[model samples]
Target: MIYLDSAATSLQKPPAVARACSYAISHYASPGRGGHKPAMDAAAAAFACREAAARLFQVPKPEQVVFTNNATHGLNIAIKALVRPGGTVVISGYEHNAVTRPLHAIPDVTVRVAAGQLFRPEETVEAFRKALTPEVTAAVFTHVSNVFGMILPIQELARLCRERGVPFILDASQSAGCLPVHLEELGAAFIAMPGHKGLYGPQGTGLLLCGQTPPPLLEGGTGSESIRQEMPDFLPDRLEAGTHNIAGVAGLLEGLRFVEKQGVQSIGSHERALTVQMGEALAQLPGVEVFRSKDPSQQAGVLSFRVSGMDCEELGEALGRRDIALRSGLHCAPLAHRTAGTLETGTVRASVSAFNVPQEIPRFVRELRQILSEKP
Candidate 1:
């Protein structure tokens, strides 16, 4: 099967990731649970993963990194901690439900959407500037759109938030291991990402890097403050509740190692080249509308498009029959579809990964053209 949906979850993980998980399952115990050798070894492995993540993201301290189930979980914790009651919260139009749903749950908080023109960075910045009034208590945005791969001007937005004294929260779910994310340079209040995407880890692992200590989302045994009912005041322990996902962390450690060794810039260049090829080919196809940047360098590895006579779901089914894996429909970002004027008919998303080859691109295009030419 040709897998092209890396944006959903990286199906092609490094061999070391699986190996580490297998080893941890047999030999390791719960971290910080006991002083036994097994537990101690597990604790060390978990801490090493934290340190590796810190170094990769340019985080100032290792302890500030908190592990969670996925990017959605991390975003919930960050949004809950940063957003003030009865205040305005600014966000981009391309945010997933992970960012929008949490804000919806908060009472009396007004959400202002800064919807820029699709693939236009200058318009996005202007929209953000207009929405970031003094009443806005915090700003949350995605570094790259999951639906269109539109790269937002995060550095400029960060600078604007800094000048306005608004806490900036970034959702790096799509851009974490695929692009260069310097936490120190961005100066965001909280950065949330999943290990399963570009990091090439298992699906259950994620990270949230905090600039300041936020209130705990879940309170339970952190193994540090057993005597007290209240959660610990420290970083990871404060947010981390219950037993650690030792096997998941072990796999994530290996994944981070792979990313570091490969280098983000090199990986990004390779992915962008694939994106350019796919986008250009799709645009040239008769009756195909590709939703992405005219300049492919400004985009990531995602390409969303639709055929003139075919429903997105029908096209996806046809591709699936051919053993081609890709995503179709709204892609969990309706606001993005609305911005791109594709709300009525969602686009077919073909996302590439490092494991994908240039040979697959032409085959995919050929098959897609055949599918589109068929009578409904």
Candidate 2:
């Protein structure tokens, strides 16, 4: 099977990740739950994973990194803490439901989309600058579009938010391990990411790096200050409640090690090369419409496209029957589909990963062409 949907979850993980998880399951215990040897070892293992995450993302403090169930869990905590009632929050047009739905749930919160033409970062920054009014309490931006893989100018947007004294929250779900993310350099109030995507960890593992401590999303045992009725005011313990996912974090540590050794720049270059090759081939095929950045440099590994005569679901099903894994439909980002003019007929998305090879692109294109050639 050829897996092409790394954006949803990385199906190809390093062998070390699996090994680490297996080892943890048998030997590790719940972190911070007890003072015994297994519990202490588990706590230490979790802390080491936190440190690894902090180093990879350039987070200033290790404790500032809090683990969550997934990117959505982390995003919810950041949004709920930063966005003020009746205040405006500026976001990119390409944000997933993870960002949009949370904002919608907030009472009296005004959402202003900084709409930008696909692959045009300058226009995106300009639109955001114009929308930064005094009434804006916070600004949230996705580092890259999951649908189109168009990279947003996050540094410029961060600077603009700083100038306006608005707290900057970054959704790095698609960009975390795929691109270089310097938390200190970006100066974002919060950055959320999933361990299962670019990080190559198992599902149900995520991290939220805090520039400033936010209020705890849940109140419960943090394995610290058990007697106190209030949640601890410390860094990670304040946000991380309940038992830790020791096995998941153990796998995440190995994944982080693999990424650090391979380097993000190298991984990104490889993925983008595959995307370019696949996108170019698809564009040349009859009746195929590719949705991506015109400039190859402005895109990541994700490519969205559609065949003229076929529905996206039909095409996806055809490809699936041949053991090709990709995503179809709106991709949980309707705003992105609207921006790309694919709202009515959702596009098929093929996102590459480091494990994917150049040879796979031609095979995929050939299969897609054959599928499209068939009469409905």
Candidate 3:
């Protein structure tokens, strides 16, 4: 099958990632839970993963990076801890439901929409200038909108938030590994990323780098402080609770290593080249409306579009029948779809990964063209 939905989750992982998980299973033990040999070994391996993540994200300390179930979990933890009762949270119009739903669920948040494409750095900075008011306690922005491959100006926006003394939480679910994320340069207060997406790890793995030590969301045993009833005041320990996802973290560590060896810049360039090729092909096809930046360099490895007179779901299935995998509908970012003016029927999402190449693009384009021309 020609898999084009890496944005949802990367299917094929590196061999080392699988090996790491296998090693963890065979050596089965709880990390940081006990003084046993297996426990120590497991804990050491877990810390190695944390260190690799720190290096990749440019986080100052490995302890600040906490492993979570997924990007949604990390986002919820950051939002719940950062959003105050009387304060406002600034979010872009093109935000995933993960950010919007939780904020809407909160009684005190004031949502604002700005007319700026995420790929336009100046527009993103201006969006913050309009949204970051005195009452705004924190701002949540997606590093890359899931619906479209719009790469937001995170560093510029984060600078504005830093000046205003408002925490900036970046949901890097779509751009974490596909694009460069320098946590230090961005000065982001919190960064939420799924290991399964760009990192090419297991589905259950995710990372939450508490850049500025956000408040605790989950309170429970961290296996470090046995005497404390309340959550520890430490960074990751304060937020991390219960038994850790050791195997998942192990796999994620291997994925990070793979990314480092492959070089993030090269992977990014490769994915963008593929996405641009597909975008051009789709644009030339009759009745296809491509939703992405005109400049390929401004976008990530995502392509969103819809063919006229065809249902998004049916089109997706048609492509699938030809062994071409694609995602359809909202892509968990209804606000992005709404902002891009593609919300009604949603759009077909083709998210390319580092594994995809130029050869796969033509097959996908050919099938898509056939699907669009065929009768329902």
lDDT scores of the candidates, listed in order: 0.92, 0.92, 0.85
lDDT per residue for candidate 2 within 1-376, as digits (tens), equals 8999999999999999999999999999999988998899899999999999999999988999999999999999999999977978999989999999999999999999989888889989999989999989998999989998998999899999989999989999999887999899988999999999999999999999999999999999888999999999999999988888999999999999899999999999999999989888898998888887778888998999988868899889999998899999999999998877889999899998889999898888888878877756
Error of 3 at 33 (Å): 1.2
Q: What is the lDDT, from 0 to 100, of the residue 186 in candidate 1? A: 92
What's the TM-score of each model vs. the native? 0.99, 0.99, 0.97
Which parts of model 2 have CA positions greater than 4 angstroms off? none
Tell me the lDDT of candidate 2. Answer: 0.92
**Which pairs clash in the backbone of model 1?**
none
Total clashing residue pairs per candidate? 0, 0, 0
Tens digit per residue, CA lDDT, model 1, 1-376: 8899999999999999999999999999999999999999999999999999999999999998899999999999999998967878999989999999999999999999998888898888999888889888999999999998888899999999999999989999999888988888999999999999999999899999999899999999998979998999999999999998899999999999999999998888888999998988888888998887878778999989998878999889899999899999999998888888899999999998878889889888888878777756
Lowest lDDT block of 10, candidate 1? 367-376
* Worst window of 10 by summed lDDT in candidate 2: 367-376
lDDT of 3 by residue, 1-376 (tens): 9999999988878999899898888885888789998899888988898899999999999998899999999999989888866667888777888898888888866777654854566886887898888888888998887888888877778888999988888999988887888888888878999999889888898999887676777777888777978788886788788888788888988999999899889999999999888888889998898886877877899889998888999889888889999899988888887777787999999998888989988888888777767765
The alpha-carbon deviation from the true structure for residue 85 of candidate 2, after best TM-score superposition, in angstroms, is 2.3
- Which portions of model 1 show Cα errors greater than 4 Å? none
